[model samples]
Target: MAGFHVLTGSGSTIAHPKVRRIGVSDILDAMRSGLADFWDRPSHYVFLCLIYPVIGMILLTWASTGNALQLIFPLVAGFALLGPLAAIGLYEISRRRERGEDASWRYAFEVVKSPAIPSILAVGAMLMAIFLVWIFTAQALYAWLYGPTAPDALIGFIYEVLTTRQGWTLLLVGNFVGLLFALVVLSTTSVAFPMLLDRDVGAYAAVATSARVMLTNPLPILLWGLMVAALLVIGTIPLLVGLAVIFPILGHATWHLYRKTVVAPPERKRRR
Candidate 1:
């Protein structure tokens, strides 16, 4: 089915893409296509995504010292919330390649010049707000269970978490809370970013469309979310270095997934 291009009061055309219900196989195909895109220029993606692991390492160091030790898990887990923002450039790269255009790494920054940048930044801000709230919620959850005082060192905190009842409770409740946040991020953002890239729809409409996609195809979207979480865990295991590969693949995959989930606006016919 074709989507609509609605003219607004200000005469701006807003594309409301039609949503499609997808399946497990579609998700797999998207990832496969994404990996192929990454392999087309692995070095470029690596250079683009190196900042991910560096940021992870910084968060690890920050959490390892002082009272921030308790934040290590939260910092790592919170990556799901912010990962989409990090991948905006990758989406552009994939989109360019798909259209048979030049997809050099520098072109990734072309998003900065897009008319949709403001909307993209608005959505990005919303994600940042969620990330901040998640961090605060993580801290509050820990404080409620074990008080404001963090352990003297990383190992001591590890012992407290592994050997104590409150630690067990924290792990259970904290992960449960984190899951809720991840789901919200997944439902709202799975298609939003890429849709924004492909269309000039406002942030509100893009987010609404993404949520609609989630409702229309819950199982596949949730499965994709779980897969992303699993891969991110593996990526972080090698001291966060693996994300140099993992993030780009997921990033490129997300663009392909968006293509599968949303129908693009029809082309305009030229008059004879």
Candidate 2:
């Protein structure tokens, strides 16, 4: 098929995959399918869900035992940036299940030896970098607004944050900056990882294809992002337990989203 192609080290070339035009209804359909997948094999997904609460508890303990109380909200918000990494296993499950194979949860933890590992790790590093920078930036914004020191106590700090102009300013600016970071990540990886699993393409190609899909279907992509934000906020409200359910649903749904939005390359003949 005639389209764009990327040259490989072996002097051969592979055609670039195409992005599909998706709609708001497609996004909803993916989520619905993801939820069904979870219920279909709930036990397989249980342990993965527990991971979030464990991490939350550890963070809570660290803040309680340490002086870095201000780290709490920043860390909480940082989850938004790192959410993609945590969903890797769910992606695998979705992939396997899509083929009508047994979707055992154990496969989620076993070592993944696919050629896509390097690209997956590359994307993971990118996410962690964003998360660390976000933490530092959040701390600086807090220091600028409140003072050089974080609030001595959690409750007092909460009070000050609610009753001060500095807090409001910091909140507004911080959210704006975070939104930019999120959009960048979202645009870059919206379908990148899933594509990696579905195809043998390199990370750069996958990323470009992901962004292409968004541009091809802007309205649906916008609605999908908004829906993700709302779900995350709602999931965070119930002491983070909602994350167990939310994570798998979104993770599985994301696989479907990638499948729906990105078109695989058509097989072609190449000169040997």
lDDT of each: 0.86, 0.76
Clashing pairs in 2: none
Candidate 2 accuracy as lDDT: 0.76
Candidate 1, lDDT over the whole model: 0.86
Output the number of the lDDT-best candidate. Answer: 1
lDDT of 2 at 47: 71
For 1-272, candidate 1 gives per-residue lDDT tens digits of 01122111112554466899899999999999999999999998999899999999988887886569899999999976999988999999998898888999998888887666777887899999999999999999988998888778888888888899998999999999999999999989998888777776777778888898999999999999999999999999999999999999999999999999997768722111
- Please report how far candidate 2 places residue 187 from its true position, in Å: 0.7
Q: Write the per-residue lDDT of candidate 2 for residues 137-191, one digit (tens) a residue.
A: 9888888777777578889878777788877787789889888878887888888
Error of 2 at 177 (Å): 1.3
The parts of candidate 1 lying over 4 Å away from their true place are 1-15, 268-272
